[model samples]
Target: MQFTKLGAFISLFSLISASALTFTLGAQEKSCFYIFTEKPRTSVNFYFAVQSGGSFDVDYAIKNPKGVIIHSDEKQRQGDFMINADEVGEYEFCFANGMSTFAEKVVDFEIKFQDENDIYKAKMPVQPNSQPNTHVEGMQTTIDNIDSQLDNLLKALQYYKTRNNRNQATVRSTESRIYYFSIFEVLLMVGMAFLQITIVQIFFKGSRKQLV
Candidate 1:
């Protein structure tokens, strides 16, 4: 349950993002990711957010190792879920963009595997000891607090990063629309000016003929 090296701790968490799926009329696109639990009753943390694309929403589903749906949602922009892995096998997490047309979706997701012992230790009350090792107990408590704070900080940073990316994508899309609209407006004005000049010239010729 204890990890001595940072690499070992990092290995328990998996961060995977699907490539952008370009949606077309009557086209259905789905991305499925899998993570395995080596032990039963492992705590799995699932976090996801739609970073960009149309409506900033996507459908998601999670299935157990037996291929039964455990959780699902439609047109969700973001979610954070914790699942208890009772079965020891690969679990499926999927994203579907079938309902969208002419717009692609970009999704950011993370799956974290945590031992049940750690979860329980954090939740369970500590029993009093008549002659407990004061120094060791104090050190352990401090370490646990630090670890919990770091985990929370990491989540916060990731949440902000996703928001920033989504906002930037929105700005770029708006800029593109504005650029094309300006061009269309300029062409419309030029066409109107040409039509007016032609009409004025025709009127002047008619007046000259009538006067002559």
Candidate 2:
């Protein structure tokens, strides 16, 4: 019973350890976050999306503890990456909004760290000695399956959220462009009307002067 309880606790802790953050980046600015690992061979999962921005894109980079660039991209709107930490220390993730001059960018990101030892322990074989051991093994398997499904669902939701944000930004930009175009069209029509009236009045005055 104690072993079962301990397994449950570890699973819960692993899931809860995932870190998520949402931040705004000013024009031509950069932001970075760090994650520390105590031991080598840890697995890291990273995900990021630009919720709203000028072009729905930004620059990003991930560096290892030794300052070696493990991953980098330019003009990316969203991404998902998994990497292994061979050296134990701090890893840096950075985002840059240098392409935008006046627009601020809103970004959402998630980071997950998994210890190899815990993973191996969770997958260890069950001895064929007692019924209780078999039951605990089955329960752990069920929990792992549930955790995987939950992760997939979360990723799907994030994808949809990114799509929604992009559509909204598109709608707003189109609306503003249409508004400006309408104002310009109205001003041009008004100027033409004024010019036409002035020309007609000049012709009548010339005719009157000729008769005088």
The TM-score leader among the candidates is 2
Top lDDT model:
2
> Which digits, one per residue and each the tens of the lDDT, describe model 2 over residues 1-212?
00011112221123244777777888998877777677788888889999998998999998897899999999999999888888888787888999999999999988877655554333545577745666777788897898789889999999999999989999999999999999999999999999999999999999999999
- Estimate every model's Cα lDDT from 0 to 1: 0.72, 0.80
What TM-score, computed on C-alpha atoms, does each candidate reach? 0.77, 0.81
lDDT, candidate 2, at 3: 8
| lDDT tens readout by residue for model 1, 110-195 | 66666635443443245687466677688778878987898899779878977897889889999999999999999999999999
Q: What is the C-alpha RMSD of each candidate to the true structure, in Å?
A: 7.5, 7.9
**Residue 143, candidate 1: alpha-carbon lDDT:** 76
